[model samples]
Target: MSTAQPPEDRNTLEDSLDALPELSYSMELVQKVQGGEGGAMDELLERYQPRMRRIIAIKMGAKLRRQIDVEDILQEVFLIAFRKIEGLELRSKASILRWMAKIAQNVMHSKVDYFSAQKRSAGKEVSLHGLAPSSDSLEPQISAGVTSPSQRAARSELQELVDRQVERLEPADYREVILLRDYQECEWDEIGSLLERPTVAATQGLYRRAHLKLRKQMRKHLEHPE
Candidate 1:
């Protein structure tokens, strides 16, 4: 009887364990934080911080970037999320990131306002126009797993260059489409809803036109840099 009856018992135990319900990684953290578990908020922030950082960096542009550190913007985003997390439905993992991206965009806008006010006080001209986003023509081919400091510096430089050209996109809707499609990773349906387009096809058409216009601008930059 040296544990000879154990195989069936182990199989039953494994089956029972497998049958237990499991929450998604995001949902689990969200639940814990909402339930007021210690450290849950920090864990949630840590998990989502990287993506938010990238969004802030990509959207802040050269002017806002000069006046505000990316980390500061990210911190504000996380603070807003933490305060409002309990009320957020966070229906899905994608929802969590989408919510954060929206918050980050808002934070960027606020910072821009503050900076513009300062410029106005100094009697400097402030322009509300923004260029379009990444171009299909000259977008940088950043290799995967290139996370060294030098590579990050190179990527940031290229991104800033692209961003500078985007500021020249005519009509604000073009910029909004690029930010929604590329940075926010929104579905066509969601983007259409936000953009007030009647259909997904219409939303896509707008994005295509915006992309082509941005590409032309980027091409000009590559061809002639002053």
Candidate 2:
């Protein structure tokens, strides 16, 4: 009556799950969405929405948050993403979110431009949480001090692996902290401010724990890649 899978069969199933491709920006997902696969776009958007919302919040800041709801901005951002999904280029596993972030920046800038024009005409000044309408580049895409693998192929593999593992970080804030500090290149204080960490030390502590968890997962995957 046990009816459980045999040990060998269970091992195979676990390996399959371990090897399951990164959910959101996988080549298969992109192709599915571009090829008009039903529900593909929905799945893709669902996977990336939380990260996208944080990006919008940082870009919009507290000042802009009062003027426009983040959800409203997210609607426009996703609308544009849906319309333009075909043009998405996946240079690396990180590419999809990068492309989406650019779209978000453009959308936020356009709204800021409208507000800036209104303020100028009214002889009032407008500020977007200390960001100007012309501000570009959501922090620099610098290395988070991770050593690159020597071989180009290995490097690319490692980068994709890192991207996948970062997406898998848990407790939401852990993912957000790594994203804000490493991916978005936010300063410690800025990360604290955006995440409401109360202090730079708090943000750093979260980043360390998140980074450790990510590294442990990455090592397990690399050691037993399936």
Candidate 3:
């Protein structure tokens, strides 16, 4: 007469469920919100809010903190999502989170377009030739005014410079590996998830290729001394 299931029964159930393809939880929450569930909306907010904050913080932390807060962006995204969510056609049940993320892209794109249009109207050329992204050399001994404290400072600056240079890599895969190894500083195994490759292959091939390109660019930059 005991109601409790045996451990074997529970294990079998869990194993069966785990056998199916796993899906992202965000999509589930978004669908729930779309169904007019108040609690689901709140749950979506709670779940995505932290990720939104971290992404914005990492991208724009040095900007004017007084002008914008990440929470404000989250609010804006929520409002925008509400207005546009009805129009979205579900590509797949799994794509709900991706669709909402596209909304975020549009929000950011619209703001950027507005500001850029305004800047152009003022007759200002935003692009300064030679001021665009350029790589730098890390030849410590070759540069002057770089010894002891100054050398350490120069080394730090060079590291930052190399990081910035990595952002300019062309082709999606090349840039991705560089970002994984340099900016986000994620492990090869973690990077593989983003790249959809084996960890050993990602490290040996993509990582190595990216690093070689970086080294060549750095040497060239030092030679030019710009």
Q: What are the per-residue Cα lDDT tens digits for candidate 3 across 26-49?
A: 566657767876576666555444
Per-residue lDDT of candidate 1, residues 103-189 (tens digit): 887877777777789889999855543211221111122334455778656555565565555455666677766656554456777
- Name every residue pair that clashes in candidate 1: 130-167, 131-166, 131-167, 131-168, 131-169, 132-166
Model 1 — TM-score against the truth? Answer: 0.67
Q: List candidate 3 stretches off by more than 4 Å.
A: 1-28, 56-71, 86-97, 126-226
Score every model by TM-score.
Answer: 0.67, 0.50, 0.42
Off by over 4 Å in 2: 1-25, 132-226
**Cα RMSD (Å) between model 1 and the true structure?**
14.8
Candidate 2 residue-wise lDDT, 11-120, digit = tens: 22122111212634567878998999847887777666655665566556556766777788887988898999999977654567667777887988878778888999
- Leading candidate by lDDT: 1
Cα-based RMSD of the predictions, in order?
Answer: 14.8, 17.5, 16.4
Query: What's the lDDT of the predicted structure labeled candidate 3?
Result: 0.46
**lDDT on C-alpha atoms for all candidate structures:** 0.61, 0.60, 0.46
